[model samples]
Target: MNCYQKEDLIKMVEDAKQLTQKGKVADYIPALGEADPSTLAVAIYSGERECIYAGNIDEVFTLQSISKVLTLALALMDRGADYVFQRVGMEPTGDPFNSISKLESSVPSKPLNPMINAGALAVTDMLVGNTIEDKLERLLNFIRQLTGNDRITYNPVVAQSEFETADLNRSLCYFMRQHGIVESNVEQLINLYTKHCAIEMNCNDLAKLGFVIGNEGRDPNSDQNIIPLEIARIVKTFMVTCGMYNASGEFAIKVGIPAKSGVSGGILGSVPHGVGIGIYGPALDDKGNSIGGLRLLELIAKQSNLSIF
Candidate 1:
């Protein structure tokens, strides 16, 4: 079982919930903007049959950028490290997640990392499928197995909203295609990318997924290796260095755990060889992170000493 009590978790959520007033929901995607910014929740998964949560723990949100970590893992398993790294670099960039300046200047024009739009598109292109539908089904099935929730699926409304306003991502795709970093049709890739990003789940489900990664790819319930050990290490390492979208370094020093946050105000964190943390608070900071979620994580990590560093 987890170390913290239910009351302690609730208190931390209450403390962080106040920050919801100071931030805004992401309106760029209209569906995402509809979230109640005041919503806040936290869940901790500590091994088999043990989960604890506080606040609006049932609030479900889209995965957004958090899906990048999963795709990177699947891509590594499908294509292997050498082939995948050859298409994307390992370094972290200080620019925004959607910024394209680095792609233009970098040698060979590959994205600096898979966490960014350019690189994620490249990784999606390598997803080993006959068509977009085939690729998306594979991704959804993988996610369902990871969470042990067969009902997990993408939010069509959010997917449609993101696809309509994804011109910036479209541009990123075209640029990569010119450099041979991606070979799929631009629209198809965007459709698949948006759909995967729109996969929705509550913090509880997310925390379980995090547990698999931190537990060396083993399923806490079934004791099956869900992800390869080397691949899990690579994913968590990327989460530490690039998962927070250029705010990673600051988050590393403050929270010191591998985490990936979404504009929907969901943060997936895993303390290597320890517990998995999932938090959701739709009120976002200027950098698109969940402001209240970040605060709660800081408190939990400090109180529980969950940092890997």
Candidate 2:
């Protein structure tokens, strides 16, 4: 249950950075396309005295799909498991995170899981708010509380960029609306979704948040409960199964821990009762995960035997 020394972490970060050159930065989102693919960073927090950091650990990036884990946790806290499960199923879709085909083909039209874009949208729609602004604020505040960082906020430019190029997401929302799955206003819900996805944080912030989850929803530093233990377990399970888009299985085999990745090249991982690891590598593999980030996790897992499996 020991954590890596700071020197070891720095060496691993340097090694992982080598893989960044082999991957491509996400270009689908115009804002994300501008990210420097060579930038690589990682932070590890043990929820105690040890905090290891390396590379551009202070570099901020949008949460992208990584925010789905937060929104899902908040939705569970707000609506409970039974009500939330009614909207999104527990199984993996096997399709890409943004694929619309599964929504069209699945019987009863429910999203296969909350980690996917459709399911995340459905979960976002379920957030209780009189307006989209209220919902976004509430979610942002929740993230701040979880990470103990009040300065965390969304990147407006990234939000606007995603909104402009979100025809596919818009189509998914409307289709769900037609099927009676999403009852909220499509535009407002989409805006909220984009806002959460654009929420920005550095690797250290991610480690702080993941540390809470690793400690079973309690802020180990303050010894306060941020989320109920049962709910935290549920969210972590989803991360282990569906967090890395279609590549979740491979990631599980390689890293053997619960993790969520964002297109902005962020990955949040919780090693149950152990450590919280956050990584940023703008370059992506075919499965849309941070290429160098995944390599880094695999290296840590192998060297440290960090995997729960």
TM-score of each model, paired residue for residue? 0.98, 0.97
- lDDT, candidate 1, 26-132, per-residue tens: 99999998989999999999886857999877888999999999999999999999999999999999999999999989998999999988888899888988988
TM-score: which candidate is best? 1
Instruction: TM-score for candidate 1, please give it.
Output: 0.98
**Worst window of 10 by summed lDDT in candidate 1:** 1-10
Q: Cα lDDT of all candidates, in order?
A: 0.92, 0.91
lDDT of 2 by residue, 184-293 (tens): 98888888999999999999999889989988999977798998999999999999999999999988998999999999999999999988888999999988999999
Off-target runs (Cα >4 Å) in candidate 2 are 1-4
